[model samples]
Target: MSNNNNFRLPYFLLLLILLSSSDFLPSVFAKSQNPITDSEIKKKKSECYADIDSGLWGGHCKSSSIAKENCALKCLSPACYELIYESDPLEEGEKDYIRGQEYKYCMYKLSVGESLEGVRGSFDY
Candidate 1:
């Protein structure tokens, strides 16, 4: 009985140690708030536009209009909108239209060999 009790004591101590130290372990699910790089932002913008185009043209959905609207809402970057047009009182549709135009211009600048960082910085706001 004493030998069995000795074995159980070590197991209980190990379990307690593991439980107490669990909070100190590195978390795999942690997210960083670091700003994204210019290239990464550009890649995301391209992907967003592709999704919008696909949603507009793809016939998988019941209504093409609804698909396009949903894709636009999902893909449009609010940060981009805020950065380009801060505190404007435009309606949602108008804002979206302006954002689209600005995005296209940014893409054109990128095609002409301008870095995304430079294009972003060139904007007035």
Candidate 2:
């Protein structure tokens, strides 16, 4: 009985340590706040577009409205969206619109090969 009690003591101590140290534990599930910059979005969008265009994402996505949506979904993946929006709860429609706009503007910027700092501000496309 004494040996059994001794064996349980270490397990109890370990459990206590784990629970008490929760505050100091690194948050593996914590969402990081590193927002994706325009340039990074541009790069990712370009890559996804290229993949779709080249039939890498799928042949069907190459010549349909789905192509645009595929690129938007690919570039603005769940992780990317979380990084960009970071806890901002948005309606599904708003989220879709934002994703589409981001993809559109990034593609335009890529094609133009220049900063759209003032261009985007001048008019809503």
**TM-score, model 2 to reference:** 0.40
What lDDT is obtained when candidate 1 is compared to the true structure?
Answer: 0.51
Query: Worst 10-residue stretch by lDDT in candidate 2?
Result: 83-92
The sequence of per-residue lDDT tens digits that candidate 1 reaches over residues 8-85 is 999999887776675544332333334445686568756765765665535532245444444443455454445444
C-alpha local distance difference test of each model = 0.51, 0.54
lDDT of 2 by residue, 21-112 (tens): 86545444433335456786667767777777777766655656654554455455544333333344333334455544644554455444
All candidates: CA RMSD (Å): 11.1, 11.5
Model 2: lDDT to the true structure: 0.54
Which portions of model 1 show Cα errors greater than 4 Å? 1-34, 56-125
Worst 10 residues of 1 by lDDT: 24-33
**TM-scores of the models, in the given order?**
0.31, 0.40
